[model samples]
Target: MRSGRLGLSLGLDLLGARICSFDCLYCEVGATDALTLAQKPYVPAKRLLGELSAFAASGPPAFDVVTLGGLGEPCLNTGMDRIITGCRETFPGLPVAVLTNSSLLSQAAVRRRLALADIVLPSMDTLVPGEFAALNRPHPDLSLSAIRQGLLDFRSEYSGRLFLETLIVGGINDTAENLDVLTDFCRELRPDRVDVVTMTRPGAYAMAQPAPPDTLARFRAALGAAATDGGVGHGPAALRSRVVDHKGPSSGPAASPHETMARVAASLGRRPQTVKQLSVALGLPEDDISRAVEALAREKKIQARAELDHVFYQG
Candidate 1:
């Protein structure tokens, strides 16, 4: 699917299940089922590589980047190094990008594996310990000092493009004290870019609301040259400057009704979406998307929540 951060991204799901190191309140894929810090081969490298090879050989549509992330953390899969190599080998020219939650970067092995990618996007929601625990609900083994040192070490050792993402939740990390500390930390890490974003979909917690426009603007100003406006209410000019607009995927044969329902279910599993948004992304009509959404809801495969005036479906 197309992403504002990475244009026309072809996602690779290393961990098929919701296995993660942290169960953040703002997780778009709902709550985590298996919350652990163990690094294991949840999905074997050979199987994933075989699937990648098959998909690449099937004459797939154009994609700008190959992203290694899914419903859960990609680094949790011990075969991450092999997957990165496989992705590079399969898609020779496209850049390989990894999206990590910054929980395991303290390990030298994890950092070594991540260095293979062309770009890495690691998140840091807050520097305060209380806020970190309240917002991320990370494993008991993880600490703020360890995570900070890991990021510093990775930045010093790696030469690839590093884009640090900070998710701003209202009444939590948006306070001036937290933003000050976070801004200083960003400067110290010196990432190539910083993406300041907020929740745009239904989060795991009900109180996780998107920050207001004025707060985002203030944070962006403080971040200076390293920040990019990635969330809502950033205005059209800033949006056009920072994001690359794509016209969904290349048009192909129309999918059957059953196929449409399955696609909708899979898409919602990744992130919540409205009917109109799904229609545009899947290249299907509004009526077809609505029908599929209704079917999924009735089957209990997806749930709908009303935010403002629009309804968003999530799996």
Candidate 2:
């Protein structure tokens, strides 16, 4: 979900359960808490709908978009269709989006449900079969060919805007061949835009690294007019302002170590930010941010990756 100083965007984490089909090495939410392929309602449609209504009635927060995504893949949730239908019926004017990993797009039903969203942001990291397995660590039954076919099929069927996201990890999917395959895939899929972003935040695997600036530039150039760094409108820069709370664990209140860790994790859960950014946004000292980030890293509650000179934390 993207937010800015202008306003915030609410992310409905409907699939609280670990329902993702992939256990990606670069997953920011850490390893799947409960990895499974079963599509069932983790967050009941009625419950989510009721909560939305209640929140609206209580003077709704100033958010511009409603995003459907969470720690787990939103498409894995069986009740997604109902939730999307209710969201459209209840808030016709609000733009609703789904942030998916494209693992389940192989299923026709899943693609149909996702089509209901106003905007669909699906990620396609690599087309190489071995790299797909190494990077995504998909479910035992899932095949790269299936995922590729799914994307192609969905592009043909869906009418909504599609913003394809390609996360470039240094030394892994940054090879010239991989980038070429990615560019070719984007050209065939014909997404409205291609967001070529690097791993600015830490991921589940310790070895996960961000692509170099030169590599990023090269990939963007390959993508041509369809490629963008800041996205069409809701890129990283636009999403970084005024989303996290200013008060932090090391401030006047003097929160406990656990509290500090929780606060840090929660902030990262919202969006990836560097230690300095987190320190400034959360009103904590740089030392405190570092300490919390380290503790979270040790616990595997959050991941950190170096991009340029700054290391960004995420979970």
Best by lDDT: 1
Deviation in angstroms for 116 in model 1? 0.3
Tens-digit lDDT track of model 1 for 1-315: 112345556667788888999999988778888899989988898998998888777675466677787668899999999999998898898888888999999999999999999888888889999999999999898988899999999999998877777788899889888888887887788876776777766788887888887887787667644333333222211221222111234355667899889888877877778897677566678898899999999999999989835799988
Clashes of each: 0, 2
lDDT tens digits by residue: candidate 2, 105-194: 899999989998877878888998878888888889887888888998998999887777777888888888888888778778877766
Q: Among these predicted structures, which one has the highest TM-score?
A: 1
Which residues of candidate 1, in runs, are more than 4 Å off?
1-5, 226-248, 280-287, 295-301
Model 1 clash pairs are: none
Error of 2 at 299 (Å): 17
Q: Which ten residues in a row have the lowest lDDT in candidate 2?
A: 235-244
- The whole-model lDDT of each prediction reads 0.78, 0.73
